[model samples]
Target: MKKIIFFHLLNDYSGSPKVLLQVIEAVAKKGFEAELYVGGGAEGGFLSSAPCVQKRYFYKRFENKYLTLLSYSLSQLILFIKLLRYRHASAIFYVNTLLPFGAALAGRVLGIQVIYHIHETSIRPRPLKLFLRWMVERCSSENIFVSHFLAKAESFTNIESRVIYNSIPQNMVSSGANHVYPYASGNKFNVLMICSLKAYKGVNEFVRIADLLSGQQDIEFNLVLGASDSEVDDFFSSVTLPDNLTIISRCKDVIPYYQRASVLLSLSKPEEWVETFGLTILEALSFGVPCIVPPVGGPVELVSEDKEGYLIDSNRVEDIAAKLAFLHKNPEVCFRLSEAARVKSLSFSVDNFESDVIEVFNGV
Candidate 1:
């Protein structure tokens, strides 16, 4: 059988890593042997336990952008030597992100096919984007994007490209009764924000919104960070949190939070960063929880304004507060949006994602 080697950039259980796991599972079901070549981190996280993963390899860190060209050259040289033993095997290199410039080079040198799966819409410095485009044009046999937003951003007009929307596994999708609104039972309405503590992710906006709505005793704000306790503490040292606001440093599983949330917020700053695709928004949708995202980037594609969720001006605290207040006041409208969100989420299923991936591999 043919061997498919995936070059992953991170060991964290984030969007890209989860996509890698899904791709590996998809390829395996198609009767191909799969292996993962991870960069930088240690061998524990979400990818370690994949039943479809035949073997795993950890390479030296190549994260510094200042030395990207040098790092790419060295990493490619190493990969070329390592893959020499599998030269005769029917194999392909599946590059998870643009960071692993080595995978394309190694595949080109080894006379193997390379598929570049792009999940980033924001690639800083025009030169880096140009370099990535040049590499993809020269090395990769196929390019797959997670959304049309990213595909359009890449502008790889000549290369063979496909936009395969990211998906969550059926088993992983949240199911059961949606959370009851606060006004109905004198309970606190839960407004949840689950994201990394980054400036571009609008962590400050979330805090600001929480402060703006602190006067409402019935509404409770919750923040689940992807950062450590100390990191969050250092970041939020100056900012004051309201009495109704609660912070959780991190969570191995976000399902419980999803189940508990009345509404999810992805107030990412469009000017600072372009979200390739908001996986958490979709996750919230699967749980019948509507989201409020900025009307930019991939989240725009996922949400329907005032239907599945609202796309508000994330910069204005008052605008966000209004939307939250609207949802809180109109429980019937909130319930309708919740049902609409679940319906919208059905289109992004793991089976569909896998099938699309398999078609790409088969075509290659």
Candidate 2:
């Protein structure tokens, strides 16, 4: 069996790490010897629970943006040197995201195959983003994108690329499977939005929607963020929270939030940060919970208009509030959408994801 060397810049409670964790688990189950060279060593994120893979830390994450960038460049330099030491035909480099350019460069120089699993398009500093794209174009043997939207947007003329949509891990799916339809909550309509504490992720927009519908006592809003309590407080210090809205932070378990959700929300700003495959939306859908995603981006691909959920602009506070109000008032419509969402989620299954990944590995 060929060995797999996974390189990820940061290991936090984010989408990229979660997807890489799934990929590593799938590859390991197939009896491949795997090792992960990640920065910050999981930080109690999803990768902390990774199975059958040796974990190694190379750098630490910083709170300051400029310091983080400096640390990132340093990590890559260190990764380039480490990858050089492990250069062999039997070992392939699996670089997660566009940030780990050092491992990709090393693989390119050593004539070893490198696969780039790209997840985002919002890389800042136009020149730096262009440089990373150039690296991918020249160094990567193949590329894996999380959505059709991303694949088309970041297409290279010569590189072989594949779109493998992220799925709910089998363990997570099983845990939510036994839950009764519309699990928990008697008469209250629970609206939930789970995302990182980033402004471009539409955190403010979600808050605005909650405020707009504050008068509706039966409807409650929940924002489950992946940041610490202090960080959450600092972010919302200037803003006033609505009485009907509840803010939760650093929640290790989001399944309970999904179980109690009447409708999940994906309010990512398309212009600033297009959501390349909404994993949380899929998780909520698996639990028979419908969603209200943004009008554009990869999330639109997951949901059908007026079926599982509606596609509305997150910036339109009145429109979003109206949709939530309608769902809260109409039980039959909400139940119908929930059933559709559950059925739609079945298409993106772990079996399908693993099979596609195995094919990619074999081809390499």
Candidate 3:
């Protein structure tokens, strides 16, 4: 059997890792032996024990700065040596992120086919972006982008790449009962913002929006941070949270919160970083919750104006507040949007993603 070596940057169960897991499963189902090489560690939290992962290897991830050159050199040497052993095994190198410079280099040295799956945009430092562009254009056999937005933004010259949107697993979507508006149940209209507690994710803006709507007694704001308690405490200590706001520290399962939410906020600011694709928006939409996304990045592609959700100026807290208020006051409009959101999410299903990935692998 042919072997497929997958290289991923992180061990955590984030968007890219989740997509990698699904790809591994798809590759295995197609009778290819799939092995995962994590840059962090072999025991990658939940991903280490994922089914169909025939083997796992660990290597140090490359850092962008010049100071880590020595360590980067050593890591690349080790990775190259390891990959050399698989040279005669019909192995193909599949890099999951743009930062796996060493893996792409090793694949090139070994004369192996390299497929780079790009999950990020907004790469910083001109030199670094230039280096990545060179690598992808010169070394990679195929380039797969997670969104059309990312493909359009790519700076590579004369390079053609495939645009495959990220997908939501079917089982993750809540089924059976229709989503009920929070106000319909005589409960406070709940607005949710779920993402990493990074500044780019607009956590501060979420807090500001919560403060903006604090005067309303019948509305509640919930911010679910994918951060540790210490991080949450440190961040919250510097900001003042309104009484109407609640902060939840990292949840393994966010389906319950999604079920309870009347509106989902993807208020990521453009200056910080343009989202390559917003998985959270689709997750919320799958649960029949309308999303309010900024007019920047890939999230805008997922939301239709006044259809699935509204695109607002995420920089202005009042604009976001007004949109939330509109939803709260107009249940009939919210219901229509919620139903449309769910219907839209059906196009980005895991089955479609798997099929696309398998076809890519076969062509390669």
TM-score of each: 0.89, 0.96, 0.90
lDDT of 2 by residue, 1-364 (tens): 7788888877677888899999999998898888888776546787777775555647776788788778878878887887777755578889999989998999999988889999988888778899999999989989999999999989988889999999888877997677666622767789999999999989999999999999988889999999999999899999999999999999888988887889999999887888888999889889888899998778888899989999998888789899888888788998899889889999999999999998988886
Residues 119-200 of candidate 1: C-alpha lDDT, one tens digit per residue: 9866778687778778888888789998898899875766788899998866666342344322233376789998877888
Return the lDDT, model 1, position 52: 62
Higher-scoring candidate on TM-score, 2 or 3: 2
Spell out the clash pairs found in candidate 3: none
Candidate 3: tens digits of C-alpha lDDT, residues 183-261:
3334778899888777878998898989989999988988887777887998789777899999998566777788788
The Cα local distance difference test for each model comes to: 0.79, 0.87, 0.78
For candidate 1, report its TM-score: 0.89
* Candidate closest to the true structure, highest lDDT: 2
Model 2 has how many clashing residue pairs? 0
The segments of candidate 3 whose C-alpha lies over 4 angstroms from its true place after superposition are 41-46, 54-78, 155-160, 174-186
Please report the TM-score between candidate 3 and the true structure.
Answer: 0.90
Lowest lDDT sum, 10 consecutive residues, model 3, at 176-185
